[model samples]
Target: MAQPTTSLLCTGLSFEWPDGRPVLDGFHLAVGPGRTGLIGLNGAGKSTLLRLLAGELTPTSGAVKAAGEIGYLPQGLTLDTGLRVDEALGVRAAREALHAIESGSTDQRHFDAVGDDWDVEERARALLDRLGLHRLGLDRTTGELSGGEAVLLRLATLLLRRPDVLLLDEPTNNLDRAARERLYETVAGWGGVMVIVSHDRELLQHVDQIAELRDGQVTWYGGNFTEYERTVAAQQETAERLLRNAESDVQRQKRDLAEARMRLDRSASYGRKRSVTRNDPHIVAGKLKRQGQETAGRLQGMHTERLEEAKRKLTAAEEAVRDDAEIRIDLPRTAVPAGRTVLSLDKVRLPHGITADLELRGPERIALVGRNGAGKSTLLRTIAGELAPLRGEVVVPVPLRHLPQRLDLLDDKLTVVGNVKLFAPGAGDNAVRARLARFLFRGGRADQPAGTLSGGERFRATLAALLLADPPPQLLLLDEPTNNLDLASVRQLTQALAAYQGALIVASHDVPFLRGLGVTRWLELDGELRAVDPM
Candidate 1:
């Protein structure tokens, strides 16, 4: 393949954690002017690579070269809550300078500070308005903004800079459907060299190409996310075919070796019988026997060598196949009868002016849709008994469990097995381990401290703990469960939920995921809960 022009380039890059765990080693990449979607499983160094490109973290070795100034919107963006909107956008000085000049101060320092940005306030407001943050005035503090709003505000700051290269990590993590759409549009219209690390499939669809980071290497694929998936699927099919052929070859070689040994044994028996029957001379017989033995050794060695080579080829073929494990488990105890009422809300008034009055029966799967700050999470929390409704009541007749967006349900100090055991005290270690294995936490993985796991691993651990609870929850509530999850992790979550035969209410902006769950009811929470058509 022809190399792309180097708008942004990194060569011989290497980095490691303080404890000497390697992440990127001698990694190299060159990206030209266009939008590129950087994708990989959690802990595959996507965020770390962005940090390196943005100059937040220094590489242990090698260098990064960019055509011009770089702008970065990190995954975990934390602005000082006390800062004003203008200050956060990095235009406070220019705005102050413009204000001084307007008041008739002709100081050269003011002109220098203002530079050519005489209309800084206007430009900032325009950018904010474009990003759906017009409600937030320049005087407003960042603390007043919601998480999704904060993300947009950060993007606005980057857009104002007009950097030559833009790098965004998980830009739509906390965004609701509307906010995510805004981001997707921005990504699609981006004109500079942009690299975005995100699991949001819709956002990825806007990219010109997909760059997958895996096993300390980068693989490039042309076109959008859908194209990438198609290419990968075809590659996997070929790999699987080669693996099967290799396995068959190994089996054939084994059979051939066994047959060769049997033939040699038969020849030795015949030679001994013929020598006794013919009464050949002792010296001649001895010489002939030695020659036969030497020939047999050579034949045996050749078959053994062939078998070993076939086995080696099989091993190599196996390595080529992908092994993205899926969650497989039976949750018969979690099943709810069709006529049973699992949960109900009566005139429930949650924070943010959300009022919901609804009843959930049987194994109804609900997709809760709304814009950011619309109290979707509040409703879920109230149903899970984590928050008290301002007015009215929430009644959950069956056992319930909630997987919050932050996935804070697991104790950081405890191991995965310990956390599950915490929820199921009556269950033995063996039982818990067996169940955890289905969640892809087998043996030593289950013993790892919860604090030491990656984003995907942490989600799985939390989910396992909740699903394997002593009573086996029949009503499951998930608040933005797909947030921060990679594509593979999202697939694992979907697989696990497929086996859940219970009432499920998932408040997520991930329409594809909700649709995959076979959502029976679509509810929109915009001040009032009402049924809506499937999105």
Candidate 2:
């Protein structure tokens, strides 16, 4: 394959956290011009690699080499709340200096400050418009923007710079459909070397290739994420086949070794009888016995060694296959009868004035889709009894639970078991742990502090706590549950939800995920609740 001209290379890169947690060791990568999607499990060092590339973190060893300037948009961006849009774009001073010179100020300093980029403000606005932030004014403070808007603003800032290499981490986490579409368009138009670390399937489909970071190494796959998936599936199938073949070979070798030993034993007995019948000398008979035993031992050793080699090959083949455990549990208490009315919203007006009136029956799975700040979250919160409706009432006929987007339902200082116990106070410690294990927090993992867990682990812990609560919630409401989760984590979540036999309302822009849930109803919330086709 021909490599692209522009390249970003890392050689023998190594990094360790302050706590002595080694993330990458002797890592190497060479990314060239084109859009590349970087994916892996939550703790696979995708984010850390990006930070290293962007110079946010220094590698313990080795170096990063880039042909030109690099720009990075981190997963979580914290901008000064007081920073103006133009300031966030890094053009505030240049715009002011240009204006000062144009207004007849004879200050040569203004020209020096403005330089040749006198149209910086125009370019910044154009970038913002391209990112769906056209209505936002340059002087508007960051605090005035929504979470999605702030992310887009930062992206716009990056775009305005036109860096030779661009890196984005979970750029679509907080974006709504419209904002996500704009981002997709921007990605499509990018011509330079771009590396995006995201689990958003739609966004990943726009990439030229995929780089999977697993076990501290990078594996390149040509084409987009879909192609990567197909290739990986085929590879896994082949690995599995080889593993089965190796297992069969080992068994055959073991059987052959045993049969050879048995035959050798019978042959030695026959030889002893023949020597005795022929009245051979005692020394000659003893020599013949020793030689026969030695020959049998040599052949047996060879068979045994072959068996060991086959076992080793099987182990290696097994390592090539990924075993991402799925969450499978029987939540009998969570099941609702088909005719039961699980929840009802009667003229429920959200705090933001968006009225929602609806009724959920049985185990209905509903997908809530809308633009950012459309009150989808607020409505879900009201249904969960976490927020008070401005007008009307919410009727939840059964026990319910809400998993918010931030996943802040657990106490950070408490252990996973302690958190689960808080919800299932009546359950014994052993029972709580046994139930937690079903959610993938087995044994010592249940004793881990919530604060020490990674994003995916914390989410799972929170989920376990909620699902194991007393009475077993019959109505589950989740708000953007897949946000910031890796692909494996997303799969785990989907598997867990698949076993949930209850009414579910998930407010997420992840259409692919919702579709996987077989959502029975689709509701779009702009300013009010309106039912739409599932498509």
Candidate 3:
């Protein structure tokens, strides 16, 4: 059945801080049906604008008008304590309304009663099962699930609403590949308007239009993320051309003005008075003075105009650079080669704890692939020392770091520089700052708390620190490293890994990345360690 349509429009949407600093001014958006991607650098107010449209906050000035109900999933889903997966959504409110109609509390006596939606739970189970989630576990307290699981549960609940408008904030953040694909499929098949704030370039490829919030205003681009990138490059090229022409004009004007000044001075020196044409010499001198004044005025005007043009061009150039993605990574050289023993599983059992033993080594970019909660992260954690094998021994011969799918090792409050510093001691403060700059944390960014860095930046910082470690680690364990990165970063990291000499044990849902990295070994973490057909 076709769903209801909702329209939203905002005009002159201005907002300011308590100190009178303006955050938004005359911001306007015309939103109708279809999917739109919202993106911007940190603190561009994407989340704030989303709140304004969702009616969660009133604009300080201007208006936000929407036609119907809006369903929104906030940036973070904080479940009620001890809530079950199916029950944490707090859908009881909606269920109560349905119950009220069924009980004739909503004027049901004059109309048909609400049919039984008891099947709703069944439908939910089917969706969960399709995504490889445990249906029986739905009744279990959600607090027991991993961060990835919790996020998936919230998404599932949001979909059950079937609202006319859907708003999601970084919806795929914690999902593995299979879960991410499942969520993407659901969004693609959804029959409503959606506004998403995400940095996942691949996911944004499906958006109808790309809307970006920058410098206190929002700009929209027609087409997917790739199209947006192409458009941005074209704009940069045009700006560069304009800047060059303006610069040339300014230079020419300066030269002409200099010549004009010299010519006027020479005329004054030669004829202090107008050519002694047998006229009042003082009158002639006055004419010369007037002429000099005229010349000076014209020259000043030219200079002023040139100055203004130069300022405009410079502003455009600066804005373009600021808006551009300026990622520069300086990964440290590893002193130690990635050691040979990458992984070892002896009689390792997976899901329901069945199993076999396996040994791994360098020259292997092995991927542990499985459905969600199929022990992919678990096995990686076991290798990382976060989990102990129940009946087998997993040994490591060299330094290793685990990129937790949840990034638990990252300190949320500290800056990336601070975090990297924690990894390396005795590196001078200047050295630390310089190291951060290599990972695109130059200037004020070095002071930014680690908690604030984008997912991609966080991973980059971690990787950089790993490289900087004394006698750099020989083994790297990554769990879904590409989950939150843009396409450009993904490619850069992929290329880096291909050139890296260290052994890699990666558990990723990104098939392309694994294939590109020449990962030859396959370990499917179903419950125990088992060697699968080599990829």
Candidate 4:
């Protein structure tokens, strides 16, 4: 069978937020059948582009054209808790109509609704199971599912539509290892045009091409993210070389200009001496001096123009080199002694009846991996004392802090500094401001209300508050820390965590990120918490 031809094209696309902040300006792109990974720094309009393609958002000044139907799965999906699994899957009416017809109701409306999807219920269930939602029934309410489960459920609904163009933004944000593989498989087998905006390195590796969005434009690269990196590395090298050459030219031009001026001065001085010695006519002397001055002015103008042109070229070269800033901080007080016990859980059972028996000492880093709703977040909350375990006890011998997946620890009404002050009450205003600056919130940025900050900024503020608590935390618990973060924010977070000398327990599905953390233990939480290979 021949696969359907798919195409998504946008021309002269321009979009601005309600507040008049420009995100994309005159951007143009055409994507055909294949997997295209959309990547860029946070706030580069990757999500905006996806939204425009999906028709969820209208472009300010351009058009989006697609060869067929479009399906989009947005980031931070929140399904209606009142909706049933079948309704969420978009098959409730079809299933109901099918059942009605089977009962001998020959209503044409029923048949119309049923259309060609007689097995809609079966297909819905099959896709749900394929995404690791086997235990969830069609009649189950959305409230009964976890956040990650809801994300997968939404994706299942899209797959059931079988649209010719698919847009998935951070699809694997809350998924586990098994679920991620399932998603990877879906992408690999997809024949239609698909655009995915994700920071997941493994997911990007499955893409056929890479489209990088930067400065309100999209640049296409011929291969996957690894190839994109190699190409970017080479581009950066060339840019740096050009910048060096431009700088050298500018310096040479400056020197030559200075020498010309000196020579002009000497010529004028010698001319004056000769004129006086020969006692030449005043008119002839003046004319000669006028010609000399004009010649000198021309020479200076040429050298100056060359130097200015070189500087402009240097500026352009510098622009080509990305200047991604890194987050750097030192938490010396957060360190733990080699023999100090940071955390201990003795037969601790969470509200979901998930049990854990664990111990950590020194600066040990542990990764908590499990499927959605398998009680990973519950376990972390239990360890953080935010929830009481049903059976046993959790002992924290050192001061600790927990960064929840939703980053709800912050008070939206308060400014970033105000929130930090609530955590570190003893610290002075200047001190708190200084620390916040280290977290990339400098000066006035620390005064922004928590509710107004972007996702990445809010995460940074929340982390700053936690780390700068009165008694420095020795054990840090982070739950899906990379959820809504862009690739740059992810790297910033990774670098920030790298400087912490404390023991850490991070519950996340990001395998690449976990590997970068120097994790000493890997724990998978299903019904119990036990050590496992990184895998």
Candidate 5:
């Protein structure tokens, strides 16, 4: 394959948090002109790298060089709700200049501002239409748009900028299926150097290469996400094999060392016995003993060195093996009887003109899905009793828990165990710690402050607190739980939910994840609840 032109480069990059927690140390990366999917575990500094490349963040040491202008879309994008769509798209000044010039203003500044963007509005509108945001007129304020729409709008702004280097972090987190498809198409058609930090498998499929950030280094994998997985799997297999071989070698070395020690002891004993039997002279016997001792010492040193070398190889091999732990919890307490009524919603009218009426029984798994701004979250919040229905009754006789997208339930100041204890006040520390261990927060990990956790760790902590509550949640509500989650974290969550015996209503746009949930029913929330075929 031909090498692409280098569009972005980072050399000797280093960064640390305010608290002296090192994130990246002497990291180096060079991205060329093509779509590169940047993937890693939650706190691997993928986002931080993008920020450094975009100049949004300054590295503690090293340099970032970009061939041209850089456009960045952060993971947690929060637009100024007061700004107009045109302003957000960064074309407001150009549009105003064009309008002023057309109105017969001969201002030099207007001409200067409109220099080459006379058709800026037309281009902006066209881009908006392409992103499914045409209905959101340029005059509309950002407050009118949904979270997904805001993400797309931010993307449109970057697209309009036409930068040579583009960095997008979790662009599809809030996007629905349709919006995600649109974003996927955009990624597929991206011409310049684009580096996307995302866990969206569909979006990753459009990338030309994968740049995995792990342990403060970048490992390049040619082709897309599937190819990356295959490559990594093969690499891991080889690593495991090497590790086994290394272990075998170490054992053999140990055996050889033991045998050598035995031989040395026998030789010493035989030498002593021969000297006694022969009645050799004292000086000769002493010399013989010293010679035997020297030979034994040399043999022992050689064997020890070999053993140490084998052990070092074993360590290296072990390091090559990946250990992405998954959540494994047995929550039998969360189980509901087959005929039990878990929840009931009657003529429930939620915000954003959404209405839902449904009855959940036993441990039915329902997948709630809809387009961006379709009020899927609203319905969930209403069902979770976080929001009051406009005009209807919501009832949940059984214990319930809600894992919102923001995961705000966790208190940052508290430790993971402390947070879980708060939810399950009656549970002793031993019990809470034992349950948290199942969530992968073992030993010292459970004592880490919630605020200091990585994205995946935070999710696990939040889930632990929710699932390990006093009265086990029989009906659990999860809103886009996979958003911002790494692939391993997603798998961990899937495993946890798989073992969950309670009824689940998960509002998510991740079709693969939803499918894996063994959803018994598919519901779409578009102004009202309606049964939909499995996506």
Candidate 6:
């Protein structure tokens, strides 16, 4: 048998919101050494349970037993990072500072009094190299760094502390392929127990085990994303079968009850008519009473069947999906234009701001491939006209729509509907809600604050606003559109994009999404203008 992880254990855990409805009811899970993926739809109590496990939030009814040191890397935690590159990486200096604090502050007093002499320089250098940050220099502040850079630095600091357990939330939300793969390698090699909550299917592929949270409970399955996927599909099929059976049973019972009531009604009326005529009164009354008993029995049976069928339906429906989004319907759409030049770029040099510039044109679907600082964002900016080229002008004939990798353009304080309306006005509430529903952000979700939405949810809202706009743009410039979308939502999005007749400029490292979208054109922005056929 595999050894159970010693540090973390939760038994019969339950947590309730202010309304007293349990979000986590009798949740049971065990955390052990090696990397594990926590899979669930957003708001399925995954984050809430994580917080309770990390000691950040207390469970309302049950206990969380954590016997080891814990370090938490929250989702999109780059906002509060005031550390320089060296400090963020916690190079040798932070470790030395720990030693100094242990050695009665002599080293600290010396380092504080004489700057780098207090061993800060040596410590910083060592940690920076260990984390591949020495190349970035120690003076760089995390606040101004790119999303990937900031996240990497944050991860390095968390690892430097070498806590016994690690809890990461959406660690690869905004990372490029190279960055995401690099993180996978790090997590695979880390020595402590790790619980990673992510909607990224690719990232989950690296996990040792997958624990799915649903219906206020946790179920663990051995293996990686592949196994988890198979399990979920099997559950869905079973749930569907149960639902069908339940519905059929309910309908049969209802029909039988209706027929029985008719018979009972006729028998009583006949008895009443006989009594009025003064004919066989005793026999007729006796028959009516017996008929009533049979009718009551039939009614009781009907009620029992109805209740059982209802329970089955409820369980089946819940098991089929963690939420209502699982119910898929046929989509309706209009036609698309047929133009040769969906998007064209002539002798266009991508701005050499972070890395390089390039001249490129997208045939059908194009992938913007590169590392974190390799100029994907810069190129997108140039194409979007957010950044003016230093030399040649790029031509964009098709109406272009871009959902930047970052939600920087979004007003954080606005409601979800408000954000969508900002991009597209004059749309009716029902129309806007329909768009949100297409993106799986419907119901009361429209009233949610953009800032409070999960990374995946925010990405969906942004795309919904852009794609649902009147006269859909012929050229779609997507910078990591799959960054935070859930599995079901991603599938829906993939289908929608696949059916689109316009051109696609996708700057993403998600090979699966690109493959599913049938990307034909491939471009790499290294330092100059060039293209490649990734066949």
RMSD of each: 3.0, 2.9, 5.6, 2.9, 2.7, 5.3
Candidate 6: worst-modelled 10 consecutive residues by lDDT: 326-335
lDDT of 5 by residue, 1-535 (tens): 1125648888999998665668899888888889999999877888778888889878999899988888899876788989999999988898999999999999999999999888899999999999999798998899988889999999999898888888898899889877888898988888889999988888899999999998889999999999999999999999999999999999999999999999999989999999999999999999999999999999999999999999999999999999977789788898899899999999988876777899999999999988888888777888888888889999999999999887889999998999999999999989899888888889877888787776667888898899889788999999999988888888878987999999999999899999999999999888889999988
Task: Report the error of model 4 at residue 82, Å.
Answer: 4.1
lDDT of 3 by residue, 421-482 (tens): 77887687898887667556678767666665555666777777766555566678888877
Which of 4 and 5 is the better model by lDDT? 5
Q: Candidate 2 at 246: error in angstroms?
A: 1.4
Q: Best candidate, lDDT-wise?
A: 5
lDDT of 6 by residue, 397-460 (tens): 7567777877666687887888888777888888878767766666877877786666666776
Off by over 4 Å in 2: 1-6, 65-67, 78-82, 410-422, 425-429, 443-452
Each model's lDDT comes to 0.88, 0.87, 0.70, 0.88, 0.89, 0.70
Q: Compare candidates 3 and 6 on TM-score and give the better one.
A: 6
RMSD of 2: 2.9
lDDT of 2 at 350: 77
- lDDT string for model 1 (79-123, tens) is 899999999999998988899999999999999999988888999
Off by over 4 Å in 6: 1-6, 9-30, 45-65, 77-83, 91-108, 111-134, 138-146, 174-178, 258-278, 281-336, 340-342, 350-363
Query: Residue pairs in steric clash, candidate 3?
Result: 348-528, 349-354, 349-527, 349-528, 350-527, 350-528, 351-527, 414-450, 415-449, 415-450
lDDT, candidate 2, 1-535, per-residue tens: 1135767999999998664668889989999889999999876888889989999999999999988888999865678999998999888888899889889998988998998897888888888888889888998888777668888998888877778899999999879989999999989888989999998989999999999998889999999989999999999999999989988988898898899889988998899999999999999998998999899889889889988998899899889888977666678888899999999999888765688889889999999999877778778888888888888988887999999877888898898999999999999998998888888888777877786666677778888888899989999999888877898888778877888998899999888888888899999998889999886
**Which residue pairs of candidate 2 clash?**
none
TM-score of each: 0.92, 0.91, 0.75, 0.90, 0.92, 0.79
Kindly provide the TM-score of model 3 when superposed on the true structure, using C-alpha atoms. Answer: 0.75
- Which is better, 2 or 3, measured by lDDT? 2
Candidate 4 residue runs with Cα over 4 Å from true position: 1-6, 58-61, 104-109, 279-281, 410-434, 442-454, 469-471
Looking at model 5, residue 394 earns an lDDT score of: 96
For model 3 the local lDDT of residue 388 reads 74
